[model samples]
Target: MKSNNSLTPSYFQFTVFADYGPLRYLFFSLCLLIYMIIISANVVIILTVCLENSLHQPMYIFICCLSLNSLYGSAGFFPRFLMDLLSDTHFISRPFCFIQMCIIQLYLGHELTLLTVMAYDRLVAICQPLHYHSKMTFRTMLLLLMFVVFYPVCILIYFFYLASSLPLCGNKLHRIFCTCWTVIELSCVDTTVIRIASQFCIVISIFVPLSFVLYTYLRILLVCRRSSSDFRGKALQTCLPHIVTFGNFCISLCCEFSMSQYDADEVNSSAIITLSLEFLIIPPIINPLVYGLNLPQIRKVIFRFLRINQT
Candidate 1:
C-alpha cells in the first residue's frame, strides 16, 4: 500500500472543513434532504411530461428538458459533496477533480443555453402563434435540443483540455467543489492563454444565449402589449414561470462567478460554499415547483396522479 504522504500530492483537499467544524453532520443531513427533494421533484416533472401525452407540445417538452438538466447538474455535485462531508480527509483525486470541474461547467453551459431555448419557444408561442406550429416543428425542436446539449459539452471540453494541459504549482483547491476557474488558479505557469480561452468560452456559452433570451422576451412583451387581455393573461401564465426560473438562475450564476473571481478571498469559506451551491440547490428544486404549480395542465396532471396513488 502507498504511504499517506506519497498519496497526499495526488489529491486536492477541500477547504470546507475549516468552515463546518462540528456542524458537518448537520450540514450533510441538510444537503442530503435537499438533494433527495431535488431528484424526486425533477423526476416527477420528467415522468409527468412523458406520461401525459397532452404535454407533448414544445413548451412542455422544453420544461422536461429543463428539469432533466437540473437533475444532471445536481448529480454532478451532490454525491461527491455528501461523500466529502462524511469523510475525515476531504480529498479528491486529480482526475476526479478535473471530471467534477467539467461536469459543473457543462451543467452551467447547458442550463443557460436551455433557458435561452425555452425563451425562444415562449416567444414563438406567444408572438407568432400562427407560425408556431410550422416554425417549432418536430425537426426544428430536435435540432434545438441537439444544440442545447451539444454546444455546452463542446465548449467545456475545449476549456477542460486547455486547463488540464497546464502545469500545477500546487494542488490545494479552496472551494468545497472543484470549479474550472479554481483549478486554473492553481496552475504554476502563466495562464494568459487559458484565461483568454476561458473568457471566450464564457461569452459563447453564456452571453450569446442570454442576449437571445432577452431579445426574445422583448419581442414577446411587444406582442403581448398589442394583443387582447386574454392573450396577455395566457402569455403571462405560461411565460412567467420561465422568466422567474431564468431570473433566479441568472442571479445565482452571477453570484457564483462573482464569488469565484473576486470574492473568494474576501468571503468566508462557508458563505462562499453556500453561494456556490445556490445554483445547484435552488434552481433544481424551484424549476419543477414553478412549472408544476404555475402551469395548469401540469398541476392538474400531478394532482390527478397523486390522487390515484393515494387510493
Candidate 2:
C-alpha cells in the first residue's frame, strides 16, 4: 500500500491515490453518466421554476432548493470522482479534501434544513391554506436559507479545525470522495468528541427533519381524506417526490453507516463496493430519476425542450 509519509512545504497541495485497478474504469463511466443527467435535469428544474412566474410559490421554492442542493452536492464530488477515476488516481490532498468535505457537508446540511422548512411549508399550506401566503413569504424563505447555510458552515469549520489540528498517520481513504467522518477516522489521535459530534449531526440532520416531514405528510393525508378526490389526488402527488427522495436518502445513509464499521485486518472489498454504490452512485442516479420521471411538469418541460431543440 502507498503511504502519506512524504510531505512538501507548499501551501497548496494535490495528491493522487488511484489503487482500485480495473474498478476505476467502471466507476468513471458510471459517475460520468449520472453526473451529466443530474446536472442537466437539476439545471432545467431550477431554470424552469425561475422562469415561470406561476412556480414562484413556497412549494416550488423548496423544490428549487432541493434541486440546487443536489446539483451542488453532486457536482462538487462527482466530476472530480470521474476525473480521478479516469486518470487512475484516487488520492486527494489535505486542503482539497477539506474543500470537498466542506462542500458536501454544506449542501447536505442545506438539504436537511430545507427539508424541515419544506415540512413546515406543507403544514402551513395544507393545515392553514388561508394564511400560507402570509406565512411563507419571500422574507421568511430568505431567513430560512440563511439559517440553512450558516449552520452547516459553522459545523464544518469546527470539524476542519479539529481534523487539521490532529497529527496524520494514514491518509489512504477507502471511498472515492472525501467525507469528514472518514477523514476524521484516519486521524492518529482519539476521536471521541468527533464521534459524538458526528452522531449529533446525523440525528439532527436525519431524524428531526424526517420527523417533521412525516408529521406534516400524515396530517396532510388525514385532512385530504375529508376533501374531494381531485383535491386529494393533487395533494398526494405534490408529496410523492418528497417521500421518495427521503426514502432513498435514508437507505443510502444506512448503507453508508454500516460500511463505516471495520475489522482491524482490513475493511474488505464487498463492504467498500456496497458503500460506494449507496454513497456515490445511487443518490445521484436515482434521485433525479425518481423526481423527474414522476412529475408531470418536469416531463412536459423536458419533452418540450427536446422537441424544440430537435426542430
Candidate 3:
C-alpha cells in the first residue's frame, strides 16, 4: 500500500452526484439558465466599462475586473458541472482536475484582491477627495490590476508544486469540484507540512484582503458620519453595491469553507450540493446585478446602451 501511495491516479471519482432520476433534466435546465445569465450579465458589465469613457475611472474599472473574474471562474466550473448534472459517470482526469483547481483558486484569490483594491479606491475617493485622482493614477490602476491577477497565480504555483509532488493513496473526491485541501486529503503520506502551508496561504489569501477591506469601509463610514446628509448619500450610492457584493462573497465562501473543512457524511446530500455550489453560483449572478442596478453611473450607461441598441 505504501508503494502504491507513490503513484498518482489517472482520474478522480466525484461522489457528490446522486440518482436524481428524471429530475436531472430539471437540474440541468436550471443550471444552464444560470450559466447563460452569468455569461450575459458579466459580458454586459465588461463591455459597458470598456465602451464608456466616463466609466474608465478606477471604481468602474475594478468592477469590470470583478465581472471578468466571475466569467473566468464560471467558465472553469459550469461547463464541467452542467455536464456532470446529466452524466452517469462523474470522474475527472487528474490533469483536468488540476486545471479546474487552478482556475477556481485563482478566481477566489483574484476576487479577494480585487475587492480590496476596490475598497482602497473608495477609501481614497471618499476620504481624501483631493488626492484621489493623483493617487489612483492610470499606471497605479494597471499595477493594482496586475497584482490582483498574478499574486494568486504565483502563490498557487508554489502551493501546487508542493501538492503535485505528493503521492496519492485514493482517487475519491467527496465534492463536485476539486479544491487543494480536498485533493490533499487523499494523499497517503503525512500532510502536516502541506496542511500548515495551506493554512498560512488561506490566511494570506482570504483574511488579509478582508481585513483591509473592512478597515477601508470603517474609515469611509467614519468619514461619512462627519460629513453632511448630501455627502453621506453620495458616498452610500457609490459604496453600497460594493458592500453588498463583498458581504455576499464572504457569506458564500464561509458556507463553502465550512463544508470543505469538516466531514459532512451525516448531512443531507442535497444540502451538501447547495453548500458546495453556493460560492460559485450566487456571487457571479449577484455581482453584476448589484453593480448594474445600484450604481447610478453603471445603471445609466447600461440603460443608454440598451436604448441605443433598440433603435
Candidate 4:
C-alpha cells in the first residue's frame, strides 16, 4: 500500500485497476477487447464515410469528426495502457507523461467541442431545414474545424504550462497514463491556481457542449410540435442515439467529480469503477453501438460489407 507521499521518481504506480485477483486480469482483458472494438468500428466509419460520397453531407462529416476524435483519444490511452497492464514497469518518463497528457487532453477536448458543433448542425437541420445546406457549408465546416483545433490546442498549452509548474516531488503517476488532474495533484508546490484553472476549464468545457445539446433538443422539440406526426417520430428516432451518448457522458462527469474528492485509499472499488466507466469505455463503444444499432444506413452497409467479406 503506497501513500501519496511515498511516490518517487524511480517507483512505478498505476491507478487501481482491480483489487481482487481474477477481477484485475478480467477487467483489463475486457477493457482491451472493448478498446479493439472501438478502434476497428471507428476506422470502418471513417473509411465508409469518406469512400461513400453520398455520406459526405454535414451530418456525416460531423460523424467522421467524432469517429476520428474517438480514435485519437483511444489511441492515446489504450496502447500505453496495454503495456502498463501487462508489465510491472509502470514508471514513465516525466516528458513522456506530459506528452501523454497533452495528446489525450487535446483529443478528448476536441471530441467535446465537436459534439457541441454536431448538436448545432442538428439544430440547423431540424429547426431551419431549408437553410441547413447554406448554414453548414464547407466553409462553415472549416471554421468549426479551426475552432475545434484551436480550443484543444489552447487546452494542451494550458495543461503543459500548469503541469510544468508542478513540482515532480516523485514522478510516480498513479494512473495507467498521465491524466491532466492526476498529474496536477502530484505537484508539491502551491496548486491552488492550477486547480482553479482546471476547474474553470472543466466547467466551461463540460457545460458548453451540454448546453448546446440541451438547446438543440429544446428547439428540436418545438419543431417537432409543428412537424407532421411521421416526421416528428423519424426526427426523434435519429436524435435518440445522440441523446443517449450525451447522457452517458453526463453520468461519467458526475462520477469524475465525486471521485476527485475521495482519497485513493478511501475510494472504494465500486466508486473507482463508476468513475472509470464512461471516460475510458463509453465514447469508443457508444459511437459504434449507437451508429450500428440506431442508424439503419450504417448497419445496412456494415452487414452488406460483412457478407461480401464472408464470400
- How well is each residue in 54-79 modelled by candidate 4, as lDDT tens digits? 77887777888888888888887788
Q: Of the candidates numbered 2 and 3, which has the greater TM-score value?
A: 3
lDDT for every model?
0.85, 0.70, 0.88, 0.74
Give the per-residue lDDT digits (tens) of candidate 1, residues 1-311: 54444433577878755545779889899999999999999999999999999999888999999999888878889999998887888889888988888788788888888889899888888888899999999999999999999987877776677567756666777788888777777666687777776767675666777788899989988988899999899999999998999999889878886776563567787788788788889999999999999999999999999999999
Candidate 1 ranges with C-alpha deviation above 4 Å: 1-9, 19-22
> In candidate 2, what are the lDDT values of residues 253-274, reduced to their tens digit?
6676666655323765655655
Worst 10 residues of 3 by lDDT: 258-267
Error of 3 at 54 (Å): 1.3
Which candidate leads the pack in TM-score? 3
Off by over 4 Å in 2: 1-27, 263-266, 301-311
- The TM-score obtained by model 1 is 0.93
10 residues in a row with least lDDT, candidate 4? 4-13
**RMSD of candidates 1 onward, in order:** 3.2, 4.0, 1.6, 3.7
- Between prediction 1 and prediction 3, which has the larger lDDT? 3
Q: Which candidate comes out best when scored by lDDT?
A: 3
Q: Global lDDT for candidate 4?
A: 0.74
